[model samples]
Target: MPPTPATAIAVDDLVVDRGGQPVLRSVSTRIAAGSVTGLLGPSGSGKTTFIRAVVGTQKVRSGTVEVLGHPAGSKPLRSRVAYVTQDASIYRDLSVKANVAYFAALYGRSRSEAMAAIERVGMGDHAHNLAGNLSGGQKTRTSLACALVIEPEVLVLDEPTVGLDPVIREELWDQFRALAKQGATLLVSSHVMDEADRCDRLLLLREGRFIADDTPADLRAATGTANLEAAFLHLIRELEKAN
Candidate 1:
């Protein structure tokens, strides 16, 4: 028999609320070690909230979320996990290199390490430019470099490629795949269905709940559709019919 696959992230019956309304309800899923998982949903479908829960930043109403065997928000998981939100987290006045180095310092990483990360994200050419002067995609790439400097075991990205040009978006996805190949578990969230085909595993969400969790090919096969987008719509219809 094959050995059991190692689990990098495990959520058991997780529930969360904000402003007295449920954001995630009894959501449970496991993300495998050394793989890329995509959480696809609409804007208000709890993708960001769910990503926050996995990163241990959001307050949970009840249930357990574990990362690498520790409870979510546990102190040990801090350095091992990295989160890149839609909003770039960088000092506008600082150069791109400076911004990445600042975050590296917080994680006890070296300047050289930061530079390597910057290069990996295709931000090397703009390293000396002030972050405020960079374009939207460039800023996002710099923020990604900061996260990469830590060499996190698990990287959670919220819509990292939403507004990027097709080339840049493809580049980011390539980097994500490379990270997973290097033994890092990555959870990338996006509302766009076109990006669904890039993931090894997909968790489709709607109205704070999962509509389907399967591979792109599997989802298509199950829905008897040749396109991932069509499969998503079929699943949504099925979910609505069930409800």
Candidate 2:
């Protein structure tokens, strides 16, 4: 028998409400360590809320979330997990190198470590450029560099490639794969079905609930579709018919 994959995250019967309205309804899933897992869903599909819960930021209505063997967001997991939001919280006035070094220092890392991270994200060429002066894609890379400086075991990114061009998007995806190969677990959220194939496993969500949790190949085979987008639509139709 194959050895069980080590779990990086586990969520059981997770429920969350925003302003008295339900956003996540009893969602449950597990993310394997050293793999890239995609969280796919449309707008208002609870993807952000779910991620927040895993990172221990979202208040839960009921359920449990464990990260790296500790309760989600516990003080012990602070340096073990890293989260990058859609709005890349970077200092616009600071140079790319300075920003990365500053964030690294926050986590007790050093200048050399920050420079290594900048190089890892392919942002070394722009290290001296001011963040506010870079292009949208470049800024995104800067944010990723900051995240890498921490060298966390788990990385949670929200819509990291939303507005990037094809070339930059491809490069970033390659970087994600490299990180996973190095034994880092990544949970990246995206509404774009095309990006689904890049992940080792996918958590398909809709209406604040998970519709499917499987690999891209498995999902495509199950739905008899040629692509993830078609497969997702097929699954939605099946759900509607069942209801």
Candidate 3:
């Protein structure tokens, strides 16, 4: 396997403001290669904001972001990390395979490689289906396959499993774990505690700051909670009172 990235993504004192209000304030985190790290938070809690910041789509009002051991803002460095958004980035008019191929072409990948990505996502059989005609789950899978076509060192996913059926969600989770094993660092933001538990490590984010960073087991044990959700609620409540 390719050597795991030393530091796939690093954010230091990252701050972002939208419409004069701070969405992410002094946030700092580091994601290592070959690990799946979950960023858990509630809606409107800056989870999406932080993800866009890391991916270089949104500008930081203060501080810095480093990806693949290089500073942010470098197109070459940005190309090494794949960012998957909740809304599947695909042309509805295009076929499933065509969507993947188009993105692969943007990354300069060959036809064979794009088809291989389609296979990896288990969508090779549906390659000819129009993207608009595919189910929600299929669209999600196709989007992920496009990301894989780039063979990025780091994958940043924002609510990647939202709106999918339980079975499809589980299937995608399995694939995500496989990607981690294959040496791709994954930083996924999710509000679903069950999905968060699937990660190797968890960063419990409440209002943009990390309230707890630990394995799901450790977090549950420390908080004496029944599950990650309960533990997260407990932590967030404590954090709110502390503030």
Model 2 misplacement above 4 A: 1-5
**Which scores better on TM-score, 2 or 3?**
2
- The candidate maximizing TM-score is 1
lDDT (Cα) of model 2? 0.91
TM-score to native of every candidate shown: 0.95, 0.94, 0.92
Give the whole-model CA lDDT for all candidates, comma-separated: 0.90, 0.91, 0.85
Model 2, 1-243: lDDT tens digits are: 122359989888899999999999999888899999999999899999998898899999998999888889999999989988777779999999999999999899999999999997778899999999998878888898899899889999988998888987898899899989999999999999889999999999899999999999999999999999999999999999999
Sorted on TM-score, best first, the list reads 1, 2, 3
TM-score of 1: 0.95
Alpha-carbon shift of residue 224 in model 3 (angstroms): 1.7
Which regions of candidate 3 fall more than 4 Å away from where they truly are? 1-5
Model 3, poorest ten-residue lDDT window?
1-10
Q: Alpha carbon lDDT of residue 30, candidate 1?
A: 84
List candidate 1 stretches off by more than 4 Å: 1-5
- Quality of model 3 by C-alpha lDDT: 0.85
Measured over all alpha carbons after superposition, the RMSD of each candidate to the real structure, in angstroms, is 2.3, 2.4, 3.0
lDDT of 1 at 235: 88
